[model samples]
Target: MISNIMTMVRKELIDAARDKRSVMAGLYYAIGTPLMMCGMFMLLIGQMTSPEDLNIKIENSDNAPDLVKYLSSKGITHGDSQSTNDKGDQLDVKDIRLVISDDYAAQMAKGLSAEITLIADNSNEKLQKSIRRLERNLQTYSAEMGSLRLIARGIDPRVVQPIKVNVEDEATADSKGGVILGVATMTMIYAVFISGMNLAIDTSAGERERNSLALLLSHPVSTRNIVLAKVFSVTVFAMIGLLLTLIMSKISYAFVPWQELGFTVTISTEFILLMLLIGLPIALMAASLQLFVSFMAKSFKEAQSYLTLVLIVPMMLSMAASYNIAPDTLQWLPVSGQQQALIAFIKGREIPMLQLLLSSVTTLIIAIGLTLGMEKSLKSEKIVFGL
Candidate 1:
């Protein structure tokens, strides 16, 4: 029986390998997604890390020369629409406008409150960080001037500062990198599903359509052995795709400027091994599920449609884990559970062994159930021939 299953597995693999559609489906995602993800991370990191100088329009600067000097010292400077940096590169000027009220320095002589108007589109996402920095510096200058005034009147400046706030961050560098890793991890997890999808459908629905499934089943092998063979073949293809994805990610991710985000994300060898270990059961479940769904469909086109919809289930689970949408229940669920454990491992946290074990067992059980169902369904002429 085992020999029959092995022979069936070899046959299925060779057949899938020769199918251009099946081979290309895994190749594209395994090779392409990591490079694409690397490019996206580079773009995001560039935006998050500011250049040495931040240029914006500052009107009526003479009204507060001291304030202007303070801002300049902090790398915030006034620039016209057409401004170039020392490198002769055109400066990317922010649209923020800071208008210093023209009171002719009269408010300072009387120790009274001064005013400044900042104009910009508050709803603009790109301008939010710059606007906040400008506001913070202005507040600092105001507080300093107020302290001088209190001292001049023989009052302690400390009287106004009744409370002092200090923050201590306890997060490790790995934990900080977790925010960036969320999406990266999601793409890797989905590799198992994507890499074997076309092959799973082809080996089942495509085989049936070509009048080959009936021939194969008519052989001296038990239906269970045939089901196991198909599942094993698809699972092997899925694992290979997953391994390639991890290798590509490891190579490509090194070029990203993770330091700009105040952390680093090195896909360590240990993490790679852990990911593979966890992914095996997921690959099996994916193969079994896809094969079962494909066998239930009458034709190749019908199977393709069904699998597309079926793929959404894993995607949703992965998405929820990535965005942290529903952590409480997802931590115990199948795909999401493994995802959370992977994320935890990436962040240098201890692996949640219980959850990992539970999820792996659950995933294998699902695969077994699906394989058995497919085996039972294969005996029915109506299901096998789509009559």
Candidate 2:
């Protein structure tokens, strides 16, 4: 059995190597995707840190001298103009500013509310939060001023507010880390699955379509050996892709200003090893599933269609899991569990060894089951024969 498996593995490698398309697909999957993802993550982190300078236009500066002073004290630069640059702009300020009309004080004194136009660049989501902060601060300042005026007029400020409440987050550091890592984990899964798909399909369905499967099957080799050989080759390529991604991610992280962000992300050696240990099983399972599906198809194009459907499973699961539906019973789910685990590891959490064992075992069991089923299909003349 060992000898037959070895022979099958050798044949699969030779065939894969000779096919330039298959070789290129493997290289791209194993190396290209990871590097791309690393670049993406770096960009995301950088944006989170030092956002672009916002150009803000504040109109009707005469009515809200206090508000203008407040904005100045916060070091938020703004221009006083009705039409700063663009009218269609969402916020009246480029970053976070409000424009008061020329008749603002007259309208307010007549028991009428005045209109404040805000122009902002909505493209930067981070800027929106800053705008909200500025607005909240202004609101508080206005309320405090009104309260002092009422007190001076012999009125109690407490009469206006019957209740007060404060909210706080009691979540642990791991849980908070989990939230950010979850997004990244989902992204990594996407990169790996997409990058690995073509290789998986070509290694199996492409081989069958080129009449290579028939030649391989005719040899004195067990079907299990053939499947294992193909899986191993595909996994090798997948690892290369994943490694390239990690290296790129590390480079991007290194270039980021960690002190400015108030937190450091040091990708440790141990983390990489653990990631590989977890990612390997996922790649094997993905490749095996694709290979099994490809074996059922008559042509490479048909196999490609089937593989595409298979790709959606991971993506859908990733999208759903990204919302972090919480680490409850659903955390034990296949793709969901893997997503949770990867996030837990990335955020410096000590993952439960049992969870990793269970996930790995479950994935391998499914892959082996599928591979065995494919073996049975291969032995049948009806399925193996081109009908």
Candidate 3:
């Protein structure tokens, strides 16, 4: 049986390798996704991070000298549209207008409400971080003045600030980058599913349509051997794709400036090996599941449609785990459990052995069950001949 299965596996692998389209499809995803993700992260980090020296137009500087000084201390200095830096480079001056009321300083003497109007295009996405920074600083200065007025009247500032919450972070530096890790893990896991989908359909429904499956089955090999061979071949392809993705991610992620985001994401060699070890069972499950669905379909296009929809289940499971939707329940589920385990491992936390073992066992069981179902279905005339 093992000999027959190995022969069939060799045949399937050779055929898949000959199909240039399927081979390139897997390679593109393995190589392209990590690079694309890195670009997206860089763009987001740039937009979200506030500039070191925010230059905005400051109106009525004489009316509130103290306020101007406070803003300057916070890196919010005054600049016009034509302002240039010392290196002769054009300064990125935001189109923000600060209109201070003429009675600004007088209101401070009487401890009355001072009016300052900030004008700018708040709808602009590029100005969002700068605007928020300005608003935050203005609010801080206002609070300081209010506290000083209360102190003059022999009042305690603590009386107004009844609830002061001090947050003490216990998460390690590695754990703080969980969000980035989660996304990276999700992409890698999905690669296992997507990388072999086309080939799985081609081997099952495509071969059946071309009458090659009937020819292969007419030989002395048992249905069990054929099913096992197909599963092994697809799983091999999936694993190779996953390995490529991990390698690309490990190399490309090093180029990203993670320190600017206040945390680092180092895809260590240990992580790559562990990810490959854990991805094996998932690759098996993905192979068996796709083969089962492909066998159920009448044609290659139908199988493609079915697998596309069916694969969404695993995608959702991985998504839930990535974003931390239901940690308690999903921690016990299959795809999500494995992902959560990987995440915990990357976060420098101890791996949950029990959950990982249970989830892995379940995944293997699912793959075995699907393989058995495919073996049985191959015996039916209607399944083989599409009658």
Clashes of 2: 14
Better of 2 and 3 by TM-score: 3
Each candidate: RMSD = 2.5, 5.1, 3.1
lDDT of 2 by residue, 236-309 (tens): 66666666566665565565544444555556677667667778887787778887888888778988887888
Better structure of 1 and 3 per TM-score = 1
lDDT of each: 0.89, 0.68, 0.90
- What are the per-residue Cα lDDT tens digits for candidate 3 across 188-212? 9988997888789999999999999
Candidate 3 Cα misplacement greater than 4 A, ranges: 44-57, 75-96, 109-111, 119-133, 150-172, 261-263
Worst 10 residues of 3 by lDDT: 171-180
TM-score of 2: 0.79
Tens digits of lDDT, candidate 1, 1-387: 899888989988998899999999999999999999999999877865665577989999998899899999988999986888888988989999999888837887778887788999999999998899989988988899999999999999999999866778876556556657888988998999999999998899989999998998888889899889999999999999998999999999999988777777788898889889999999999999999999999999999999999999989998888888878788788888999999988776887888878888998999989988998999999988889
Sort order, TM-score high to low: 1, 3, 2
Runs in model 1 deviating more than 4 A are: 49-54, 73-75, 121-133, 167-172, 261-263
Top candidate when judged by lDDT against the true structure: 3
